[model samples]
Target: MNQPSTPASWRMWLASGQPRTLGIIAQTISTVISLMCALLFLAIAFGWYMDPLLALHLFLGAILCLAFIHRTGNPLGTKNMTFAGALLALLSIACCGYLVFEQGRLSERLPVLDPLTDLDLVVSVVLLILVLEATRRCIGMTLVVLVSVFLMYGIWGDQIDGPFYHRALSLEEMADHLVFTTEGLFGPALDVAALLVFVFVIFGALFDRFGGGNFFHDIAQSLVGNQHGAPAKVSVISSALYGSVSGSPTADVVTTGSFTIPLMVRDGFSKVRASAIEAAASTGGSLLPPVMGSAAFLMSDFTGIAYSEIIIAAVFPAVFYFFCVYMSVNNHAMRHNLGASNKNQLPRFWHVLRKDWAYLVPLITIIWAVLALNRPAFAAALACLGMLPVFLTKSQYRQGFFKNLIKGLAKGVERVILVGVACAAAGLVVGTLSMTDLTGKISSAMFALASGSYVLTIITAVAVIVILGMGMPVPAVYALSAVLAAPALIALGTDVLSAHLFIVYFCALSAITPPVAVAAFAAASISGSNPMVIAVTACRIGLIAFIIPLIFLIRPELLLQGSPTDIIATITSTLIGCWALSGVTEGYLLGHLSKASRWLLAILTALIFIANSWISLAIGLCTLIFIYARRHQAQR
Candidate 1:
């Protein structure tokens, strides 16, 4: 008997590496074909080819799904399973590719079950299966199960009795609506990813290639490396600068914490505390402006908010968050008397600026484009790439400029796989919610659960999303929150962007929450601290973020929603609240706090949030005086 034939996927995957010249030619051909198709859509779509445009978009989405599945590998099982997955992916692609090939030919009958072409329905069911399976392999069973539960709800919603139930969609109709319409797999959620995010990622990766991560660390260290508790402070500043762009908290922790954590350990921080500090600082990276990871991009699509407005609203909170971390690090240093070096021993701030100031141009230009020129996000990012060539003007980066540039672009495309996969999975959730009308149903139900009290409703929404956020990627959490928790809060009369951002803030914090904190776990690997311990410790050090959402919720002004005076007052009040809370929680302030002083600090924190303006300020004043007097007495 003839030997069993190996699958083509295995041959292609394996052969991709060998016969190097032929492989290069093949890859080049594939790239040309993809570009031609892309250009075709661009030309036609601009000329009002709506049906073909949408068909092409959907078609490309299917290809993306397949690519992600292949790249991520069939982690759930072996080669046999991987083969089965590739087969499903191809089938899904064929279904979509057919539409691209015959864009306007099947206009009326598309996705509807007819005697002639029930293939659309068949294709859709399989495609949904493939998406769920792909989600399982890439993300895990949690999101897959969540998507499945929603699928069931869309199918059998009418049969269920309750406010949550909606008239169920017919099987054919559900498949058609999901596969063919913009609301389903290729909806706004995916559009944001397809159009905007990958461009940003590629540009950022290139930016990183020229040594941006190290540059920021160098600047941060030179500025604060000799401060009391310099190591902890260094971790705070460097991680923030790096995380602001890198966006993956775990990756950020591993990259920066490897350096910062060891430095802190030598400087007298317990391994656990050092790890926790790095984990917490890196966890806040996604909240920083300019990138804020994929969440900000998704927010722009979900809330119909402008990217500039989103970044602006995030400014105070991000600053406050890092400031709080800085304070905690300072207290830890003072308590331990960690650093004794003066400014003379540290790198001159001006000297470091002179060296790395060139890298600042691209960052500043990107920001200026987004805010001042109001250029499109993708174009703004692409423009940043222009700076990469300029960096080669330096003698050091000159030798490997082309090589480093290629590596960055290739790595950027690889990174896109993970983000693209998450975005597509999120689209499925968005699709299901749209088809079932379950998003509105949940929003209404939440309003009832809180008895129509605005504060209660907001609190309930945050609580629910935070629980769901556990054990998930930041992108997944933010995506799920867009449809679930955010709608509820927005329904309760919250500012639209503020409400959306509140969900993001809480979801971002889950990276440091216990049980399955990704960032903390990464830090644990570096510091050898208990992951759980690091996670809990991160929560305390990160108390600033936990409180920020609540502040911005009640005072939308801080989200750039109100007059300048209102913004200033709320921000000042919030600053005082954070300072007091961090002092009490970390057990340090101007000096070691007595029990009475801790109580006083706790009371002041409550006053900032609950009391009237004058009263809160009065309390803030009193707290400031108390700190001054305590420090003075200690000196005596």
Candidate 2:
């Protein structure tokens, strides 16, 4: 008999496995590095620094091991590769280590009588670029390509033809950017990755391995598996639960999709519909609170707001998102005559709960810890370690618990590597902008374009964030956008949390935006649907993505920044908006809606529900009354 093939076998079959293990492992390490970076930042924030040398040693050791051990089949000779990898890894680690342990010591490395005398600057620049290359190898060519374009723009400013162009950088100046400064590789993106986002990423991974995600799935299945459009409802509940922890749409897709997609298909949903539902719902995870797609980290860091505030503010908008999705699926289910499978066929809720009851412990523990302590990073880290005991009690799984525990730890280490390195690389952009006062120039240019219209300025800013975000991953996108857009929002009178959340939402949702919808494309690939169709469907299903950002801007109370009364009013209004929008978009509220009615209802709902002002609400109410009158007249 033939033996079962491994992931390597499938890769060979597809002719695309060259970076499979390494890529996954690199991503995993990048997540952990992000967490550690955050911890170091917390230390800085709290005034307790880790030793620079120790942090450097820890980072370098992990990188060298991954680069050498995992890159064995690549072109480089083992010995040469080992030496180069170790050198680069150590250098990159040194940069972060210094930042964490020697917060004020970086000035010593700055150019003095001779700018070339800056040893730290030179080493860091070279190492940062090397890290960028590694990230490119692991993820894709897009980010590297985009960063390269920016670097080229920086250097060729004088030679450029466009009005926006500036003077080019000398090699030394480029080094100042790519290595020593905060803009290029160590900018806000890296700062968040290192200090805020990493812990959540680790929390996500641990949540999965410790059965948190599965627990969510089981609970969702039990709650809605017997309802009309049960599959889609499962998608809703499961996605929200998973989203709270996972923080990435694509990660949510793969996690929940592994089970939900097949189940949807089996239950009379088309491949396209099933994939679209999962894609849309999974994307919401980034918008969901707590972990919140790692955007919360960047938001807090960028706006100088507390993580708790961001979480609290985001709660209502996220609920609106899930509610819209839930309504969409339900309406479609009714319209199409879809219903739950035979009762006996559904998973036994009590049994599933009993079997997986313990999985809830970790998530509950993490939530309680975060709320009680008001420390998101430490809460996540502690939660990650705490999940292990729950796994050890099962005899069936206990034998390998220690091995898996080590593997999990190693996985954590590997997950953050690229993020760490990439942040260091991207810091070039930030460092250069700060050191040269280029960000101010760019900001001035943007403000110039606005001339005076705050709304246009906001629209223009959102456009910029979306465009830049197209090239970077979710975390990087949020980090970059928060820096550029948050200020614009603040200038427009948006509160701190609302402004940051607005940009962060757009950046995260950019994963499903057109032309570069990575998350949608990934799901489409699995569902074998046209990528564009998946993208459009995803955008439609996640309509809240487009509106929620605007709503928060319109009413900061939507993000829970106002008094209790205001908060209640904002949330109530938003839910009404969500339901009306859902009725409009999905073409159903109480029953099946005609195409004309759907269009009219959708418009009326948006106008009435979202326009929380009394005048708009009154108009919306009259419109709704007219619609009902028309429906009754038609029936008669």
Candidate 3:
């Protein structure tokens, strides 16, 4: 009998390096042949006789990768489970691949008709449902249930309630749209995933091998780790590092929270405070640039914006967000009388730098390449890989080069699995919406409810984003918002970039909001705090998230939408706005604020920030000064 499969965590590799595991990983010889056969037949059936073998090969490659992943316990599978999963995964690949290849090949010859063939129709529907289920198993039951509801609406539209109700499409039509066309399921979402998202995943993995994590941690430590609230600040910086690479808030929290949360607690931070700080900071990572929480690429494909522009647009908001979190931690430190680092106790900055200086070069090179070249994700991946040799030359880190390399690659691939599936599953959502014109209905209804009030429209849109974000990750959150709320933003006369980024910011903030806060959940697991308490604190600390979106919505120039002077003005004003807002939220400037002063400053700062006029900025500054003077006098 075959040995049992292991879990996908690091511990599993240590427990068993069994030979069978490798074969299972390779999906054995028989499984590969079966998958290849499936693809060959699929290609022939699709009338791709001219390039039958080539199409079959691509399909086979997809299937083999799918089978290897399934067999590796990467998904919820075992040895026996692998055999069946490999077969099913192979079949699904063949079906989807043939559909894509055939569609391309037939475009010039003949238009592929609805429910093109009986075989195609049945396989597409079956495979779609399977993909959804696979996504549910890997991510959560929430998205599956959500998509199921959508499918139900399409099938039973006449019976549904509310303005959302409409005549339903037949099952055949639904399947045909979802599987065969770009409108339904086999759409840009999946295309972006297959092409762009995977490369970034590899890029992120390569960064890790180049000691990107250590570089981030050391830099954060050197800069902020000696402050009064050093641990909290470190959490912010480290989360940014992980966020830029991982692109998931929950993943960021898990990666950095274990170290930072314990450090914060040991250094006299409350469990709730420490966990909240980490949670809020980690969630902000998705909003950070270069990697930007993984939505920039998707946003580009969906909105026709440049990827570099998304990165540029996100830079200030992300900075403002982390600044707010840092301020919260600073205020907490002051309130609790947390002491600053003892010079003798703190690690020597120069020593830390000298020790790991080489590790830092790769990250710098990556950022330079991205901004300077404006190249694709693959270019970034190549740059990162090219820099790895320099990092490996360090004597201390050299011993584990190969080990880290493999681990990073494996982790990166594993990270992409659920995300890849989520995108595919979201294709179902996008596919259904496009096919049924459900987005138009939702948008029109949202508009009717707002009745031309921009504020009300924004409120409703944000509420939807927050609600959707609770059960989904950032990509899915943005996907749902892009489908539903984006049109609402466009209708309000907002720039397309600002509108989508606004939706994305709100969706990203949800990871720190109450109820189903994934980041807070991860932090709380380590800090032993009540998840809700941590989540509420996280929301408070991440207040800039709420404000920045409003800023971009009001002043689209903030998203790098204007001339050079306009861009400079927007950035300057936004930075000042952030400072004032941070001061207000902390209830401190020169000293602690009185209750009245805090409220006044908060109101004035928001007014000025949103007003975006010089006069408003001047008045806001005066109020800030007044608060500071009053606090200074009281302290004296």
Better of 1 and 3 by lDDT: 1
Q: Rank the models by TM-score, top first.
A: 1, 3, 2
lDDT: worst 10-residue window of model 1: 13-22
lDDT of 3 by residue, 86-165 (tens): 56666666665666666665344322353356776777776776676466555566777778887777888777788767
TM-score of each: 0.86, 0.83, 0.85
Winner of 2 and 3 under TM-score: 3
Best by lDDT: 1
Per-residue lDDT over 352-374 for candidate 2, one digit per residue giving the tens place of the 0 to 100 score: 87777667666777778777878
Residue 270 displacement in candidate 1 (angstroms): 2.1
Report, for every candidate in turn, its global Cα lDDT versus the true structure: 0.72, 0.67, 0.71
lDDT of 1 by residue, 1-636 (tens): 966656855543322111111245334433443344333333332342445346435535544543533443433223322454446556656766765665565555545454235776677777677666556555566676777788888887889887777875788787767767777776766666655665566666767778888877778878888779887888899889888877778778988999999988988899999999999999889899877867888888777778888998899999999998889888878877887446666677788777677787777777777788554453445445556644655666778776676566555654555566666677777888877788888888888889999878877887778777766767778888878888777766778888889888888998898776879989999988899999999999998888788777777777867787766777777788778787888788988988988898888788786664446667777777877888899889
* Best model number under TM-score: 1
Instruction: Evaluate model 2: give its lDDT.
Output: 0.67
